[model samples]
Target: MNVINKLKETAVSVFPVMVIVLLLGLTVVPLDKYLLIRFVFGGILLILGLTIFLVGIDLGIQPMGERCGAELTRKRSLSLLLICAFVIGFIVTAAEPDIQVFGSQVRGLFSFVNKNVFTFVIAAGVGIFITIGLLRTVLNISIKWVLFILYAILFGVMIFCPQSFIGIAFDSGGATTGPMTVPFIMALGLGVSSVRSDDENSFGLTGICSIGPIMAVLLYSLYLKSQGNFDSSSVVQISETAEAVAAGSPLSQIFGPFEEISGEVLRDSVISIMPLFGLFILFQAFLLKMTARQVAKIVIGFIYSFIGLTVFLIGVHGGFSQVGSELGFALGSKALSNGGIWFVLLIAVGLVFGAVIVCAEPAVWVLSEQVESVSGGTITRKLLLVFLAIGTAIAICLALIRSVAGFDLKWILIPGYGLSMLLMIFCPSMFSGIAFDSGGVASGPLTSTFVLSFTLGAACVGANGNDSFGVIALVAMMPLIAIQIMGIMFKLKQKKGGQK
Candidate 1:
């Protein structure tokens, strides 16, 4: 493969995020030697770590995912398929880098709440949901009717959830359904469709998969409820007062399974990889029925992916994540900052993120290409990317605004999803599927970690905003609006047979 091309893709994925950090730094951080050196070195490490990650995903994780998916599909019975789907979704989601990032972030506030259990449960929830999602797509069910009922049940569950956890649960939904899950889940949909009797049933896997975590987390919150008082002031602190605020960099804070102690980082590393490796063995032995040789090669690939990921995680947790939190916190802390600065920053970062998302998201591009080809180029990549870019920009702006105004995320989410669900009733069958799937794909890996962090920092710190937990939900929501709205436009054009 072209190493240069690979690097460019990684850079694109990292660049918009880096730009946001630099912008925030200029506005808030002093241009002294210490700050300058810190930013420069942090920037370099983040880029390098991202490069390693992209290479790993391409080399190992993606292939293993595809293999697992293909193997899982060979089973024909519904119960067998559901069982396979749950296992695959659970394991793969368990390994997802983005979800793990969010869990660690939450540990900043909820001291006793285990990040590991949260990750595993969410992954299992997604797996179970995806199994149900696959069944819906295959059976050709109405997307809206299902979501309407499920969300209603989900909201009812939320009534009993701890208020502190309500946001965490909603946020977990967006965090878990990311780049790693997208391609493999989409592939699973395709594999199942290939063996099924209908073509329309294979699409729209995202609609169902996207909502699974929402319900799961909301339900899980009930368990956390009896722990008493959801919003414990001691566990988390909020401040608008002028103080020299600083949190140590993520890398230096935690070293790995054995970084600081009796090789604790080594233990952590094994803990991190075990679910994945264990699932790999299970798939090879009972699921795939493949010979030792094939499984060995996949294992080799996973190792490279693992190394790249380890470096990447160390880099983000140590470097970029800290930079992101501080930048927003600093900027938000500044009451003297101009609205013009916020507006300009929002538009600029939004556009950059939109462009970067269009090209660097291999999974999104791959899925888009398939749609265009399947429809005999009736759906052009140019059109798909352009609309997706436009949607991404809008989403980013809304997220930034949430930071500035301290808007309740549900205000955006409720209306945005309501509109998306409404459009499902009118848009073309295929476009509806593609549009809903686009929501999950648009947020992807890059946005979940970096963009979401940037928003959280600015809202929580820069603006001294407390209600900033729902940026991911908004990020996930905006794409639904843009894509579905565009789908309506496309439906109009298709009716006129314009340029087709």
Candidate 2:
């Protein structure tokens, strides 16, 4: 699709969020003028960035990933394909903007760990899991069994890890599967799976790869604990503060957020694309040599992607996060004032916020559109979006509950994933993969930044520091069940039609 068309689509996704926040500010949680202005500008930036990013994915990243996957499969050398898969997965994930945000957050919380080292650990996990996913497709193994075994291992590791790390590990998994990584990885999966004449295997690689980070983080946490290096008291307090815009012309107030974030956003945007750019060049030279014209088109796409991603992150950080946090704090304080009776308000608002926010997630758009395309319209994008939104809403409610109640992460995640695994028995195979993949995509950059910041804001009201950490984790988990349930119904419908 053209950029204009993508812009309109993104506008529809983003404006609801702006409207909701505006209404909340006017009625229940009044935000100051400066913050609201920034939010409006942020929405505009989000629309523009998401539009350009989608176009770039179509023109550049998806094609390259698919071609690389297809070419590797055709080579008929398992060893080479596995090695390349690991390298691609590792580098691409390391460059993912979402992972960087997550790593930095963890680093900010615990100054003892270096952000680079933490990100490296997360990237290594992705690389190893990508290899396993590719191998599963090649060996024609059932994703259900693979998922079962992987989650079993995840839970086993979760037992010994510290409370602080549990949420971070799951959030890390979700973060790795963000805008930068989802399109390319999903395309790569399609490319590899296309080698087989079946559709079932095409949808699960992202799902499988998401598992890697969770495992890796959990193991790292366990190791930290074993060495007695973890100092729980050293963790920094999580809170949000909206600084005043610089005193100057009116234009300064309008442009404050953009100006504040430009430098870091530019640097991250460059870092985010470089690894993938280098990998694409390697593939072009070795595996999929194309004409000069094709090369130029891909290069143009990369440029678009870089610019789009930079603008998107700036918009999110500049506009959405502070507002979300402010609103959450307002609501949380109100809830507290009423002797905690206002917890219901948290659930209701969280549901609405979660529903709309997931739609704005760039990766959600990518995954939904890709699902429809890959399934030849059998599984509609609207269907995927609806299910994802529902799942995300439930997840937000759960996060808010934890924020107020201060429950253990195990109580929610363990049972939630257990149910997800059980649902796979009744779900169609393709849907199983799609559902798992949806979990990752549902909790993209917007969830990590906006939704998560909102949850943290509420948690801070009660001094529930650790409660907010797993919002992304819950956001990632719900889709596994939602999509699987949808898949079961779809399967039943097919059976009924056959009987008729």
User: Which candidate's lDDT is highest?
Assistant: 2
Against the unseen true structure, what C-alpha lDDT does each candidate score? 0.63, 0.86
lDDT of 1 by residue, 84-106 (tens): 78887887677776676678867
Best-matching candidate per TM-score: 2
TM-score of each: 0.78, 0.96
Over 208-280, each residue of candidate 2 has an lDDT whose tens digit, in order, gives 9999999999988877778776786778766553454468767777787689889988998888888989988
lDDT of 2 at 45: 87
User: Which sections of candidate 1 miss by over 4 Å?
Assistant: 1-4, 12-71, 95-101, 104-120, 159-163, 197-199, 223-228, 231-235, 239-277, 287-297, 334-385, 461-464, 498-500
Residue 151 accuracy (lDDT) in model 2: 93
